[model samples]
Target: MSALGTPRPSPLPAPPPGAPTVSAPEPQEPRSRKWIVWLVLILVGGLVVWQAAVKPRMEAQAERASAVSAIKAAKVFAGTLARTVRVSGPTSSQEYTSITAPIMRGPEAGRELTLLYLVDSGKIVKKGELIAQIDAKTLEDHIDDIGDDIERAEADVRKRRAEQAIETENLTQTIRVAQAELDKAILEEKASETRTVIDRELLKLAVEEAQARLNQTKADVAHKLQAHKSELRILEITKERHVRHRDRHKTDLVKFKMYSPMDGLAVVQMTWRGGEYGVIRQGDNVTPGMLFLKVVNPAKMQVEGQVNQSESSLFRIGQKARIRLDAFPELNLAGKVHSIGALAAGGWRQSYYIRNVPVRITFTEVHNKVIPDLSAAADVTITEEENVKQLALAAVRREEGKDVVYVRKGDQFERREVKLGLSNNTHAAVLSGLEVGEEVALEKPAIQMAALR
Candidate 1:
């Protein structure tokens, strides 16, 4: 219709040969262009995919990368570990004391008074250890015997005193006699003064006679007094000796009962036979120097532990120590090494003790629970640690001798090589190849999960 439009197909443009025609873009609304753009892109993409397999190559490369990263890791390291040393032993005492007494007289014998009270081996006594007592009846009998002897001695002394008094009276009488004679002689001599030289001979003869009588009396008195000197001295000494003997006997009797010398429990010094393991009774007899009982101080107590040669090396002087009594485990006690053993063990597996060089420790605090004879154990730790990586053991995977972790990157999981340090059943330590706060896959791969359970 246009060619004729009739008026001359006004020379329509000649058709071009085998040339692609592109349509002019028409002006469009925003809503209308969105669908047309999407359809054109879809068609182009379909043709490209048909010509080349894009998805297969992408998948192959991803699989190759995953295989490369799934290697296991192991490390050689110098490990320092905490070791414990165990030991067991009993305890002992440091000081001991003894008490003695002498028991006397009766069926118990003439020994000192060590009998009549409770005393024996293995028997404990209080501070005032009165193991035995003197028999009251026996002591009373002795008193009676001494009283009889004292009475006899007193009689003898009194007899000598009487004799001495008699001698003194005789001496006084002799002196009086001599004085009277001398006065008579003087009176006679004075009376002779009236006589003259012719009659002086007769008066002189009378005076001489009186003088001779006085002289004789004086001589008799002197001889009587001097003759008994030795006898008098003997009598005095005997009386003194008897009195002293009585006093000394009484004093000795008082010392017959003995008591504990120190403030502590007492044990029977003598056994039923012989040793520190017997009973002492009130009726048992003893000598002046015999042991009666023993005294032991309580209050001083300690804990003891035994260690083998191998374990002893870890235990050093000044190292920290801890103790927990089976009776009181709730109570934790601290202590320091006071000393270590000086000698080797004499028995197998520490069955015997040398006691010469046992390792010793002084407690920091006093615990009443540790008695005189108590056993205990100890542990010593030497290793210390600080911040380190840790993880749940279930999340880690290993292939060959290498360790691997699946880290989440974008939409897919990527395999990563990791360095592992140490592990226990529940936890594993990460040495390197990972950082804190990074996303990692905890959910197991399907094949790995099935085998793990």
Candidate 2:
């Protein structure tokens, strides 16, 4: 106010001497409130980031994991695709002779015969060689008993004949004596003319009585002879029956020892016991008419096997096959289908309901190792296609009435329809709509995709 007659600016008040000077706090918001607001803003930003990026990423990761776990994939390949029917069975011979249990008779009839001895299987046997022996003790005993009975019956018949002869002789002598008496009586009656009337009458009565006695004696002798002949006939019949029975038992005893009729390898027959098949051995009882052994010509070998009904149609009379023996894996034999059964086997009452057709495969060349009853597997080539694109059957699926496969495209599968040519249990030949070297899903991919959705 003193410089040019104008008012001067106001100045701060002076502090007290030697005292600490303090300025009042400027007007401001609270620190705690500012911190709370900044914290709230950060939380909102984090929630927004999670909703925009992290949550979706985590969900996608879960879906990818599920897809990986659920789907299986295979690579398609180009190769020579051959549709083959595979079957397994025991090897046999085309011409074989079966040795069966002998026909039993007499006391041993209608009962199973015990196997007393059996030759080792796979032995080469000549004609008339013993292959098996059945228990003949019972039959022998029966034959002995029948022989005794026959002897006894024959003796009885002889004794009866002798008695008949003796009785006939005695009756003949009595009849001769009666005839002599009648002759004497007749003479007496003729001489009666020289006697008195009363004496003549008496002599006539005596002659008539003697004649009646002779006639009665003759009738008695004839009747006795006829009865003796009838008794002798019955005894002879009994002796004949005993002799026939003895002969029959002897015949059965001879049959107990089985001999091979031809030169071949002998194979034991399978006996059905306890609901399963087992090799016939000594001590195993066999019924009459049961097959006990088979003599097979090793020079002419064949395979007897069964094929499923599905593959039966592919087998023909001349279809070529390659056989592999399970016992001798190194031996590979060539063969052809010789025969196909007209009926299906193994139906109801079987452990499984699989129907099979009997097939006979004849070997083109015989080998010593390819013996009878060796287990073998045959691969019969039904059809062959060259340089064809094939995919596993598992990769092929049916969708909308069309064969479809899922082709892998950049970590994802794309559905494509395919035209199938030749197919088998394991693979299917693709004629169109699929390419070689492409990866295809072996299982359905739609399930995993649906789950992800």
Score every model by TM-score.
Answer: 0.42, 0.63
Q: State the local distance difference test value for candidate 2.
A: 0.85
Clashing pairs in 2: none
Q: What's model 1's lDDT at 353?
A: 49
**199-232 in candidate 2: lDDT tens per residue?**
8998888889888998999998888888888898
lDDT of 2 at 363: 88
Per-model lDDT: 0.58, 0.85
What TM-score does model 1 achieve against the real structure? Answer: 0.42
